[model samples]
Target: MQKILITCEHGGREIPEKYGPYFQAHQPLLETHRGWDIGALELYKKLVAAGADASFFSETSRLLVELNRSLHHPNLFSDITRQTAEVEREAILEAHYHPYRKQVENAIQTFISQKHSVLHLSVHSFTPELNGEIRNADIGLLYDPQRNTEKEFCARWKQEFEKLDTGLKVRFNYPYRGTADGFTTHLRKLFPDEKYGGIELEVNQKFPQGDKKNWEKVQQIIMQSFYAAVK
Candidate 1:
């Protein structure tokens, strides 16, 4: 048997009320891609909306703590948050980061424990322009090129997506490296090639906010193609 899990690491831009003061002048930053992945959480909802048997969840904000990063990763905290005391940063780690990672890790562990092959899709969105660099990909599927199962799955997925919309730009391992340190990458350490496949799905923020109908169409195409490929 096989299963799918969808998750959004940078979901919302919420700074807990207790820590709101720390981000006083940075409220606008929260609204932008830096704080939380624009449209990622909402898109997560759409992907799993059909009641798929997926263990899905959303993170509050990347600014508070980067859920994608490992325990010792330096970029876990943004510049503003890096200024906080060690105790405060540890609190953020304990309060939010670890639990989220454990939840995902446990989900995979449980599925594979039951002798099920798992196909996990960690949902995310990237800014169109970052530091004056324009990102041309409309959708990015990130998976380890060394993992033949994952690599082939993404290739078939991209083909299916392009079949739906010929003009849609689907790239593999664009903007960021697929094998980069992330939740999926961490899971790979525990599960071998036969039991697990992790792919990070990155969509451009423009679709979610740019047009109402187009966004919905893109959402539908993504879900449809994903199902088709996995089937």
Candidate 2:
């Protein structure tokens, strides 16, 4: 049996209360798409309530230290905190970054050792429009094309979504590429295709950022699609 592990990296826009003073001037940025994934957390909650085996999240805003980005990644820190002294940055890594990654890595190893392949679904949300370009997908299932498991899973997942809501625009890879630098990609190096399948579920912010009724509707559709696909 495969076990599902759900994670929402940029779930909250909260700057730790201790770090609040450092982010006072950057309040506006904290609420933008740059701060946290707009609706990823809510979707994550829905997934958990729907029976995901495990779920993890960071309540701290991504602006402090991006959870998705690698430590050496250029955009790991937002403009506001990037210039902080090395000591402070290291503190953030110790307090926030390392622990999350370690916990996830350990969890995957434990599961795989128990004879169950692990499916990691990292939930995220993207802005409807970036720069002047309008994003064209309602939902995007990102996975490495080179991995047969990833490729086949996404294709069936997209078909499941179509079955649930035929009008929904489910894109293969959009807003961002799956193979690009990120947490799941990082895990691919550590876990093989047979033991681990990592996928990032990117939902356009338009759903949860829009009307409450429609957002609830979409969430239902997502769970229904999951059940259908698994069947």
Candidate 3:
């Protein structure tokens, strides 16, 4: 069987030198949740070292493109005016988005050919509050209705995570709902016959930010839970 494959689309939030000034002016917003999920890449690396094969997109600019979002999504930019610059948008899409998606597709295909059962895990982080209400959960799992595998995986994951930390607040399908055309959606559709599983994990940023000790603690807990699930 093939080992599990992990991916983090919004791993880093870095503004390239060319876009540094723009980001600097809007630091409050750009550096916030709009840029990248803080520490997600660090957690992803830990997962990779724990024996899971991982892949991610690399870019030093948030204004460029979002690896997780579909290319056609208007949210690709911080503002719609960015679309006016056709050349820049095209360059960002070609250089970042396309390559990232292609890498994931290739990784899945490679493992399938080896006759391994593939588990797809996408890592992300969420803000404690959106609009005005505070989100009560510490973790959120998103899954699409078309793929029942996501539901099954979330249930198993929740059980494992809760065992690691009894006080941990975990929920199934909250914060963001999985869409049929999302990255996970595309991959599941392409590999319907494989023992394909999809999981979208959302960690509340406050936990890690408030307590450095808790950050590593949660990372270890997640790694252990994932290892158990795949093994």
lDDT of 3 by residue, 128-209 (tens): 8889989988888878766666677777788898788888888877777766346886677788734677777788889767
- What does candidate 1 score on TM? 0.97
**Local distance difference test scores for all models:** 0.88, 0.88, 0.74
**Candidate 2: misplaced stretches above 4 Å?**
none
Task: Write down the lDDT that model 3 would get.
Answer: 0.74
lDDT of 2 by residue, 43-106 (tens): 8898878878777888789999998999889998878778899898899999999999889988
In model 2, which range of ten residues has the least summed lDDT?
222-231
- For 71-159, candidate 1 gives per-residue lDDT tens digits of 77899899989999999999988888888888888888888889898888998999999999999999999999999879989999998
Predicted structure 1: clash tally = 0
Candidate 1 — which residues are off by over 4 angstroms? none
Candidate 3 C-alpha error for residue 224, in Å: 1.2
lDDT of 1 at 80: 86
Per-model TM against the reference: 0.97, 0.97, 0.90
The all-Cα superposition gives candidate 3 an RMSD in Å to the true structure of 2.1
